[model samples]
Target: MTVLPNNLVFRSITGPEELELFNRLPYVQNDELADDLARGRRRPSWMWMALDGDRLLARLSWWCRPQDDAPFLLDLIDVDDSAHDVDRCAVAEQLLRTANAALFPDGVPVAQGTPPPEFLRFVPADWRADESTRRMVEDRVRAVERSGAVPLVERLRYEWFAGYPVPRPSDRLRFRGIESTEDILGLMARALDGTLDAHDRLDLQERSAEEVAAANFADEFANYDTPRTWWRVATLPDGEPVGFVIPARNAYHPIIAYIAVLPEHRGHGYIDDLLAEGTRVLAEEGVPNIRAATDVGNVPMAKAFERAGYDTISAVVNLTWEK
Candidate 1:
């Protein structure tokens, strides 16, 4: 029961019975909503909307793993496009503030995912240059910023379809499954020394590089619902490790979860071979597509992905509120 301007009422969907009302928002597709509900990644109480009486004006929703009681991210927030720019920003800001207070009283970090290029086909060809679309996007981003969130990183999402050509593996490096968690951690420590991953770099500001790398490894490992046998380490002919790649299935698709070259071995162009091996592993699995992401600023990694024949599918802007 939060108060608002324009005689709007702010609240979560009443229950499963009000799902239609929740899904009726212009931004969400009914089929996608239904799929998420069936998978337990979304719940009625996780969707909060600002309504002008019975008319929906704004909405915010959080997503989480099926087994988790708390949400891991705030992925969706939308305001009515028909509203004035100032009003739209105000409504969205208010909705987010109220939703944050109710859904995350303990002040957990908030994370969001942006759709990739493939998903933006419905948008106009020049949407990025279009004034209205640009303003709307900026307004929403500003509203989120007003709520104490900051853009954490910009990542380029890449996809390798089944028929795409995966580069032939270079015999210069040998690929093998990870031996043990300790061994992998030791490699991760070395990988962090000259890491270009934005999230990893940002984390180094607050924690020791090793601690940040370890925490990242743990967080990623917890998300894999698939076998860890897909993980591979690349080494020289003499068996000294050069780098590693983790090819695993996430909640949605098979992904190159983590790939890194040791700081000492970096400039030798071994990353291309490592990436090819990871893609070859997933391609052999016959998955429709293998998805991967790298920080936009990480030109070497981005180049490796392109050379491996992965298409740039989308760009993701991750905004985070840390406490």
Candidate 2:
């Protein structure tokens, strides 16, 4: 094989060790991102690059599956916002070329190959707020367009960090973990009321709430990396159920797998009790961080997450085809 050089260059590096440098770059969610890649849930195509002497920037990441000759995912197209001297377009092109070589199913490059991999470039809506960021995104989008793929999915990435004091135990609400399967299914049915989210709506495909609960359990709950025993359900002293939270780790990150308050329970501060109890469970386990997200349009629940100290890491906008 022949190696090449450039005046302003970027190239691919194999294995986790070389990848670590890019992964550690500022603003990269290193550990959590690595967890996604390692699990085969996300893969970087070439781990693309840009350089001018010791100064460097990243342009795009392509996650592909060689078996299907498919481009599966793309993300983390970030850079040091202050470093605006380099040619953003050229950097995007060069980095994408690296992805072609390293990720092409037959070891071919995009320039001489079937075409560029179609991918999703995630950015906080503020990406184009400045020249460098805008240029970087523009060039990448143009490159993909030129390569015969569409700039398909656009999403928002949210974040929260720094210190958040745990809520003081509320006098009106007390919490405890659920113990038996029967109780879990019971609460889940009540929580189902007034739910408009897509995942919950999937419950309609089944004949009963128990069936709905079972399907949700297998697809989501059964796959968690954290203990189910940590899940909590909230209730009133008169034995009425209000809300619940299931804190667990999935393939992506540690998360609140499920949190809902019955429709009748909405507007009251019952959500605060549920959020605190859920977050407290993870905090008590000493997990350094947890990741969770909901529909951007779900205003109140989103607010609840912020109050409970969850910074939105990213927004997943879904697309589907059906009958």
Candidate 3:
């Protein structure tokens, strides 16, 4: 446990028994905290808090895949917004700095083979337009920046409910189950050309498109325990490849995990068809809702989701040690 100036106690929760104490500052992930801990997606050591004696001042935590041993995303961080007596931002910054030093003394974990986990915060879609929300969000961002991180990207999150209209499957393109890993990886690599997605762009900068495709396939898509038959490849009626979509349930939600249009076919409204096919697959499963996210700058994809009856429910801010 690290103690800050002014007698602020900084340390991780000792165990699940301290969850009630850890949850003093409310956030969206609170509902899943218990389940996440039980399922091994979170661990007590990964959750830290700053306190003034018995009062919670700031908290931080990281999350990861159930099968993984290390944290993958720093999804939760909060400062007591109502506490006016303390520099809440400084408290948060100190909490992040201390936790990260203990968690990653070697700069980056060799097991993860990337930079430290990025920070994620969820906020209203109009986070910037509202003064109070903007202030709160920027405070956390500034605190994170002071801990040696920078804003990476903002993404627009979307959700489609059961009552919403799912676009009809395309007549111009036929959808078929994925034939083989190699085939789909080839398609994914080709789709990376001139990509607008920030995550994809980041990978492309460090690795070949094919390398990124194979890595993503192994790290993300292949890790899904969901049925692979739900994955689909879109092709012209003449059997020429157009695009593909992977409609699957993730740990948290039924999602259109990925949908991409090949660079050559991008401008012809084919993305709408691809998204609809993915949505149709998940909708047929009778899910209550299907959630997805795209980089905020990817306006075309955002419009496609909006066109397909998915509501722009919220936005996600991602911060990383590197740009």
Top TM-score model: 3
lDDT (Cα, tens digit) per residue for candidate 3, span 52-112 = 9999999999999865778889999999888877777888999988898888887674454
Compose the digit string of candidate 1's lDDT tens values, residues 106-130: 5543333322101011122234697
Model 2 over residues 1-323: C-alpha lDDT tens digits?
11222555566545556556666455444566565467554455446666555556654565543232354455445554455565454455456656655566575334444334445554455666777666756765665554445433443343333256665447676566786877787778766766656545644554476677776776567666677789987878776777788988755456777888878888887877887787778777776676666665567777777777666665443332121
Where model 2 places Cα greater than 4 Å from the true spot, the runs are: 1-122, 125-163, 196-213, 251-253, 309-323
The candidate that achieves the highest lDDT relative to the unseen native structure: 3
Considering only N, C-alpha and C atoms within 3 Å, which residue pairs clash in candidate 3? none
Please state every model's RMSD to the true fold in angstroms. Answer: 5.1, 7.6, 2.2
Clashing pairs in 1: 116-314, 117-314
User: What value does the lDDT take at residue 286 in candidate 3?
Assistant: 91
| Superposed Cα deviation of residue 18, candidate 1 (Å) | 3.6
Model 1: lDDT equals 0.76
TM-score of 3: 0.96
The local lDDT score (0 to 100) that residue 65 gets in candidate 1 is 68
Worst 10 residues of 2 by lDDT: 314-323
Worst 10 residues of 1 by lDDT: 114-123
- For model 2, state the Cα shift of residue 297 in Å: 0.6
